[model samples]
Target: MTEPSSTPHATAPGASASSQTAASQSAADETPASQADFRASARRTFAIEEAAIAALESHLDDDFDRACQLMLATKGRVIVTGMGKSGHVASKIAATLASTGTPAFFVHPGEASHGDLGMITPADVVLALSNSGETAEVTALLPLLKRMGTPLVSMTGKPGSTLARDAEAHLDTSVAQEACPLNLAPTASTTAALVMGDALAVALLEARGFTAEEFALSHPGGSLGRRLLLRVQDVMHHGDALPRVALGSPLRDALLEITRQGMGFTCVIDDDDHLVGVYTDGDLRRTLDQHGDLRALKVDDVMTRGGKTVRASMLAAEAVRIMEENRISVLVVCDEDEHPIGAIHMHGLLASGVI
Candidate 1:
């Protein structure tokens, strides 16, 4: 009180400088991590998961063969079941198995207990997944499946767990550690199960002699299916759309036919209506370079003999291969007698989605 100062209750300018510095440091710390840091984290996960898959090679045993034989002998579909993260992987495995000649589908363990168990039968085989081999939801189905007399194949981390002990075949998928920094989340474990599922699918596919055509039958709505199943006859122009000119006809007639059909070429046929040659854009270029007159040329003189051809039964993908290999844009679909029955051009192949 004796010395009331000029700046009473006011802070000295430098007294709280440490606090200002701390605020600045906090703002800088709030900035998001750099991409490099994130990438390093992801790379570590990849390495961990890769090592988990590699470890699977050494763990292979006779149980793998037993599992395959049980599924192969099943008279009904393979019912795949799991819980939580394992359930998601089981769904994909079922899809892969079904697409690769093994009849299979996914049934959630929880749902299976709630009347979905009816989907399973004694003739079917069950493949179950549980990283701990002690998931209550999945384990609960054990007795019911056994009562149904259905064989069980299990993939689990614990070899001595109840599920593993009850299974006809048990695949050990334990990893030394998880990709998770905390080692609590499902990371490497899921990858191991997925890889093991893929192994089973491919093995069954090879054992069953599954062919591409049969695989295409299951996947008939996409470009993959079109490439394998779409045929030349499905995409080629035939009947009244055929562009043809008899051999020895005026070259202008072939040109007009090519222009009318819009396929860039016209078939040159003989009196027997058998394809003898073709007049194409390439032939047109040669003719223009060889002769100046427009009306005096015969179709036979300008036509390329024995033009590239495909059968109506040939796959559109095979047609694409032939076109790419020969550097041609069109192919005549012919009968056994070499009669031009249809025409397929690059545009048609593109439109069919088989190219």
Candidate 2:
């Protein structure tokens, strides 16, 4: 028997299977038109998926709240399981949840029957995905899951399906149709499942009061964590590496400090080791414009007094903001008494992946 056209846009209602096949073949032969068709198909598919997601907005009801609460209250991780395309979606959802402060991991249904089921614990929650809701492998484990006292949340199109009926909570991810021309491939359904997974992850994230710092902790190896949690003191040059000059020091001597530190600037301090002012490359340029005798001028004479500085506790990102706002490339990190302890350059943020 010939299959029904998955799309409503087919040329004619009465078109024979052979005729449809010929048209598809002919269309495929025209390279430019084939590309256009593929683009149009993908665009339509995205629209359908977007619509599927939008449809979920109203469905974010008491069930969603309960799901978030369940996940948050659980002591163990979330175990996501599915078959076929849903397994792919589950893997991504698990990764998203893991990175966003929700402890989660994907468990394939096929693998579960082969002994991976040992991973499930009573403290964990199972998030099962199957469009038909009747996936054999997934359903076969339902009894074991129940025996373990693990709560199940199912995402499926058929609300009456066995998986849905057995689940403690069911999330409807049914799509009206698929983006595939044949309506057989998993397209819109998978999109809906993925979006719902994201929604759940985010809701749980907020309910748990998960902060960016918590998220950063989970992703410490990436640039994101560096930007969000790294401190200026963590990357700033400290100790003897810092270039310092006394207030009475000659400009030529201060220049030697800048050169030895290779920081393009030097801090001018008082006899008490308290920072009095800063002398930078900009100061050197301006001083040169004045045609002053550098050998005779004191460090304080051309220094920029009360320059912008940051605390050691300040985030590196905040330091970047300060630098950008002041139009400067460096900052002197100071103590409570206004004594320079360390220095950081703008490029340091870049090198450390904070920018």
Candidate 3:
């Protein structure tokens, strides 16, 4: 028998390669469109959330004022409570309120029912958060809170919800819709609640006349606290560490004192030990340019008279402000009688983290 003729399936070598090339081309064509769709979705989400937050400005009405007033007048702590995502936001709000001089703390709604309710007292004000206003754990405490005579402030998306109706003051955090594409996840709604909480905290802060110094006291471990709370006396070199020279002391001797103390300047004092002037490296340069003999000049002659001085009780921040405004680095810390008791340099302030 003759050999069978070869079929096209066995004869065509490029057919399999062509099929694979077509498949890869199809996948490559779909990828860019998929990426574009993701970008469009992200933009839409952001726009929706932005509009949601902007709409909140119109909701700031008398209810907001009443909420602020209640918090401001509360003698005891503001008890913040929520469930799920709302609970996380509640904890942050409580921290902001407490740090800004309004006494507040978070108590989980579920925990509240299990004996943590004892944390609530008649004097304390309850700030409850719920997006739906129907959270079972949160709503369960409303009756008990009311029975205890505790003032209830509710933040909810539904104005008609049970929590809102029972609250002494209700803040409407209702959003048009969530940023979630499914409209199920909490996004815009949570952002709105956070912003509203910030508004309340700031309003109360201003109403109470809370100062930066008070804020620093609450945040003692932070850099802001060091800048606001550190005093000149706290960072200044005192006694033997302070570079000092008597009046009519040689300019060279003053320079030696500056070098020995490593403060870049020396305090020139009169016979009574009161600060008369300051001799600094800048003065030394000027003296060197004006005269030929460093031994012939006196510290008082070349020293800048009546140098900028600060009291020991003055805030380090204020001293730094004065230093920047005057364009000088060294500050003579003086007592009530204008006697130089301490010396502070920019380096000292920077080293102590008060700058």
Q: Estimate each model's TM-score.
A: 0.89, 0.88, 0.85
* Clashing residue pairs, backbone N/CA/C < 3 A, model 2: none
- lDDT by residue (39-81, candidate 2, tens digit) is 7777888888788778877666666766777888889999999
**lDDT per residue as tens, model 1, 1-355:** 4888857346655557768889888877877763248888999999999999999998789999999999999999999999999999999999999999999999999999999999999999999999999999999999999999999999999899989999999998989899999999999999999999999999999999999989999999878989999999999999989999999898889999989988889999999999999999988998999899969999988799998899999999999999999999999999999999999988889987887
| Best first by TM-score, ranked | 1, 2, 3
Worst 10 residues of 3 by lDDT: 4-13
RMSD of each: 5.6, 11.4, 5.5
In order, candidate lDDTs are: 0.93, 0.89, 0.92
Model 1, poorest ten-residue lDDT window? 6-15
- In the range 269-340, model 3's lDDT, one tens digit per residue, is 999999999999898888889998888888878999989999999999899999999999999999999999
Which one wins on lDDT? Answer: 1
- For TM-score, candidate 1 versus 3, the one ahead is 1
